[model samples]
Target: MTFVPSPSPPAVRQPGATALFCLPGAGASAGLFAGWDEDLPATIEAFALEPAGHGLRTDEEPHTDLDTLLADLMDAVRPYAGRPLALLGHSFGAVLAFELALRLEREGTPVRHVFPVAARAAAVRTGSPPGREPTDEELKARLRALGGTPAPVLDDEEMFALLLPALRADFELTDAYRYRAGDLLDCPVTAFAGADDTVVPWASVKAWGACTRGRFTVHRVPGGHFFPFAHRSARADLLRTLAQELDRRPGTAPRRPDTPEHG
Candidate 1:
């Protein structure tokens, strides 16, 4: 099969006092957050991550595991990952962002905060998967149920055939990779979950606390699966509001070296 890489995002950017990294959901291109820069506070500048397997890095084959993807992500993102840098991801992107923060911490790169949407907490235990690859039918069904992909993309044979490999590769990353215990991040974690997200439930998301000491909070948004995309303004505003609050707090712990959290 011929390789048609994922789409490339334009260099749209906004000036801000803080930088916010936005991660898209499963089977998503960075286009999902295109207008977020204009909607959010100027105190925060926003950019999106298009994982190596897709987008500009499309010539590359997709990785079956999240860590393999993360290695590529860390290289792409490290230049931009300075202090007070924050990360926000939705669905599968959320899990990756959270874990990336932890790994960066291990590498001595401090994180300001992590905001994840529609995904479970890092500490939430997941059972071993029965399989790595899903049937083409099963992949389409999951995408349809998640409501992230457009109907035309899912229904059209040409587009569906074009997008299936990336979609299935993403599912394999989530399915085949098991979450192992890792060190805690000194940066605070903020979780966003849809009230009706079936794949990752409220209880499971709340368990994200296990990864952080006491520096964590969960916000229940009104939607299912793709809450950030569905409630764009509200979601963006919530993150902007929280990030500003963090900025406002003076001497709010050291902004570097995983500032120790209190109980």
Candidate 2:
């Protein structure tokens, strides 16, 4: 991670009245949100975060830790802080979202709300994760269980080799990642999980409630770990509902006058 800000896709309006900054899962590109479609209401704008080494700039190295990852993404999102901002991060991306919200609050950048989908609450490190990277076969098995990597990517040695670094980097990041839990988030937090996601058990996902001081709600949508794959309708409904709720309860918008803008 050379501390380069990742670029995001063009802004799309959501159906509601707020703006959404979305972060994707590890080894996944911004393209993962394509299924979201144009379901966003005009009052809301949606922007999906595209980390380096995926999608448009697939050649760059992947970032495996919070410090570098959030610093880079904050650079990408700082410019849009002028209005009420909401975070929507899934899986490992959720970890980044929690950090981003905390950092923004510390810097007086009013991140009004956050939606950490498919991730456990940051406060609870119920178990210690492996401190090392996985073997090649182990990596393949992990990827297989997630159900997102294309078969070609798994079967093609050259392609798999190219994508391996980022994928494993993500795993290492998740494993060694520690949440030095401190101040509770002032913004409301919501967690979503796939009903059948065996990887991140619902019990663990529900634990996300401990991360926020304002309010927390956990919902289980139908499907598996990559349920976002088949539940476009459910996702749209959930997103819309969440955005509507936030709009009605519009918390503090960015009040900082000196915060530097980045893109």
Candidate 3:
């Protein structure tokens, strides 16, 4: 994945601002986060993460293997390591954010917090058998049910055709993922769920608490699975919560040697 800076530059980037990395869900591009930085506090700088075969890198092949994807992401995000970092990912991106958080913590960079929106816990499996691939039509039906993708795009043959490969690859990558237990994160975790989302249950959203030893919280926002972008109130609620977290923990903190038990 590659980090794409927000299009509109902030008037003045506060000194020692927290780097807020945003990741999009399957079949979505970093464009989902466009204009987020403008809405966020000056203390937070938002950067959208663009995966292979998405957005500006449309020519690149999408990654099917988790390890390979993470390795590439690690390299891509290394330059911003020392600063206070926070990750916010939606759905499929939420799982990726969790895994990336683990890797960064292991490498001695302390992540301030993790916000997994509209996604199940990392340890929870999707229940799809390995090698089970959904047909293009099935994928379209699923998208329609989810309500994130626009109706016109789904109906437009050219646009949907261009998006199909990335969609299929992303689903395959997510399905093949099997969580392996390790040390719980020291950073706090706040999982967001849509009040009306049916794709992921409340239990699954709360289960993210087990992934972190620090504070754990779950906030139910307005809208369904794609609440992060689809609903204005939901987006405002997220930015507000994020601002509070950044205010509480100013600048970067050193990584602690001891790991606390999962809450």
State the lDDT at 221 in candidate 2.
73
Candidates arranged by lDDT, highest first:
3, 2, 1
Scored by lDDT, the top model is 3
Each model's TM-score, in the order given? 0.82, 0.84, 0.88
Encode model 3's per-residue lDDT on 161-211: one tens digit a residue. Answer: 999888888888877777677647888887888778899897788888778
lDDT of 2 by residue, 73-146 (tens): 88887866776778888887887788888888888888767887777667765435665556888988888887
The candidate maximizing TM-score is 3
lDDT of each: 0.68, 0.71, 0.79
Candidates 1 and 3 compared by TM-score, better number: 3
Q: Between the candidate structures 1 and 2, which one is better when assessed by TM-score?
A: 2
Scored by Cα lDDT, where does model 2 land?
0.71
Off by over 4 Å in 3: 1-12, 249-263
